[model samples]
Target: NLAALMRIKRRELLLILLVASQFGCIALGLVWGASWLHKWLAQSFELRALAEAHATTQQVAVRLTRDGTKNFEPGTAGWERLQSLCERTTVPYDGHLWALRRDTGALICHPNLHEDPSLLRYSLGRLPIVSSGRAPTLLEAINDAEANDEEIASGTIIVDGALQLASAVSLPGTNTVLLILQPYAHIAQAATDFIAPLEQIGWIFSFGVVGATTVLTVVLINRYEDTLAQSNAELERKVQRRTQSLLSTRNAVIFALAKLAESRDKDTGEHLGRIRSYVTILAGELARSHKEITHQYVAELAIASSLHDVGKVGIPDSVLLKPSRLTAAERRAMQLHTQLGAECLASIQKQLGDDDFLELAREIAYSHHEHWDGSGYPCGLQGRQIPLPARIVALADVYDALTSARPYKRPMSHAAAREWIASRYGSQFDPEVVEAFIGREAEFRRISEARFGSAASECDDSESTADSPANEEAIAAIAAGI
Candidate 1:
């Protein structure tokens, strides 16, 4: 089933099939060719054996003729001497050399008579005859040899339970024939030895072809897999680049919307930018001490902090633009801006699904004004009840307001603003967030000065307030105004 599920292209599959077919054909060819070669070698070896036996018989006939016994009478001493000469001749390759009485098919003598004395007792006619399917009998073989002008006649026979190749040759000038018998098993073994090197060569060729094919196939598959891996890596990189581009565009849109809300108060110059930088710095520093403050959290917090004042867009222009401190009802109306901004962002988040940026913005907008002691605003959320992003933005918001020029007051110096924030720790802000702000106060001041010019080092007398409910409301109003 896994093989069935594998996705091989038609071209690749076809190439594999073709290669396998070629290997099969090559293997079959090697087997068939080896068989043919073996048969050829066997036939050639048999022919050479027969020719050597015939030559040995001819040499014996020549030796007898040189002894002046070629035309000797049958029962004469010279004839007996010629028979003794034939019996004394040494045969090569364990062959049997003997003579036969041609006219009556009687045996004369043999070189191996001592090993097989029965051969001297029978004439060719009396010897046991054996046939191998369409082959001639010994008598018929002798007749064939005589008819063929006394040329050597070769045939195979079973003698004493062993197969033998018998070659018969007529004597040159006598009524006698020379026969040489070699064991068929011995000739067969010689033929096998003769072709052993050739068989080895065939095996090596077969193995080489198969091994080369396997190596080539493996190399090709490896190359194909490497190419596929590179393609997947390239595709992943392209997707990441496109995703980053889309996120950049979305962030640009979010910032533009936040800036639109900030535009309601002309005095809020670069307020959103300063808040982003401050929240980023505070969250970055807090990340070192808190596992929850991750790089992603810090980045989202920076973008979300800009929307802390987005709710002010819902306030009436009269109350929002008032140069003096607001009445209780006017301040209450302005406070509803927090809920308005949160609701607006929540609706957008529902349409966009659960986006991290929009979710953080909604939380910061609704809860940044909430206090650490449950006394700060629309909801009396205490301590950690306030979202981390909201608590972080709370300190950043108050610090920026104290240091920037507002419609109701001149800018306070960096030292005065720092003192004001330090005094409110644990009551107006999360202690950890306050600590992070204090530790990185210099970076915060740098960001503030970079956006709005450095504030004069003088504190205004009217900006200082006593710790009372009336003064707290005024301070809360000023902190939320930005």
Candidate 2:
């Protein structure tokens, strides 16, 4: 259930949890170990202080006995001698040394006799005597020592509310014990000094471990996310490549279909190719200033322009192939080609649903023959009323028609065609489109010559090329005027 709740993979989730648990255990162990170490160190320090104090007191007791002042009798020469001897003796650990009466538990002589008389009075008045516990008082330790026939006794006690450690040794052949007192504060200080560095080290080590773990976790997560992002980017690139391949295949099929229709009109040599190139040049120039004419639109327009005259396929061969000028009836029939081509593309688009390239093709096929002044055929769309693709194809088609040789007439030179189109700027052509064409006339001449050779010379009466032999009779009758 826990695994199902997590969105991550089970293996990754388990790995994260395991790492977290390990760190948690390590932190818990550090805390528990540090506490145990502190307690152990404190107990050891207390025991060590007691042992050292007992040994030093025994040495003091030995020295007193050797001096023959074992019996401490006040106002006696022996007591005075004992006092003088104690004053001369060097105490260890800067401690206070005194003699206590075993029977009364009274402090008899101390080294602070003259310096602090009241302190000696206080010590002699209420010397603490604990009977039980691990830290017995000085009197209790001495009693136990006497019963056990021990020479030394040591324990902790409270004197005037200050904790102190006391050690006593019975002076041989005397009713006295030599006692040494040291403040518990001194022992506590030693223990604190010993444990302080360890505590600091423990804390530093714990923080270092946690900081390192945090840094490692952050680095690992970043690396994983980067890897995931790279994988997603690579997947998108592959999908784009596949999509581009499919689009290329669809474009090739469209161009082939347009070429099939052109095959019916033998006089149009490389007509689709020149028209597509001319449209590209004009659209590219317009793109520099026209916001609507983007690079993508220009590219789609180039391909769609090839199908501009595809409706010619629907015309009867007799009218469409007529060598001479068409009659009004045949002209009207020829005009129907525009509507027929639009309907053909519209049907394809209906099957395929809305498509950018096919929609543009239908618009161009239907409206390319329309005039800017509304004098053209089909729907008679004028000016901006015609779609931009259709407007672009219109100029490209007229340019190709004027420059290329036809079944009836000679081809016009690039200069003559340019002037002819420019002459009808607002009527037969869009003023803006004619201006764009004027700027790129040199490119137009290059494309025309590359596709259909140099423009045909002015037609000479005796040098006219013959039409197909199958239509010679109709052509000879039509050629009578020439």
Local distance difference test, each candidate:
0.76, 0.73
The TM-score measured for candidate 2 stands at: 0.46
TM values, all candidates: 0.48, 0.46
The C-alpha RMSD of each candidate to the native structure, in angstroms, is 28.2, 29.4
lDDT of 2 by residue, 245-302 (tens): 9889988888888888888889888889889899999999888789988888888899
Q: On a 0 to 1 TM-score scale, where does candidate 1 land against the true structure?
A: 0.48
Worst 10 residues of 1 by lDDT: 453-462
Per-candidate clash tally:
1, 0
lDDT of 1 by residue, 294-411 (tens): 8877887898788888888888999888876788788788889899999999999999899878888998999988989998787889988898889989888888887776645566
lDDT winner among the candidates? 1
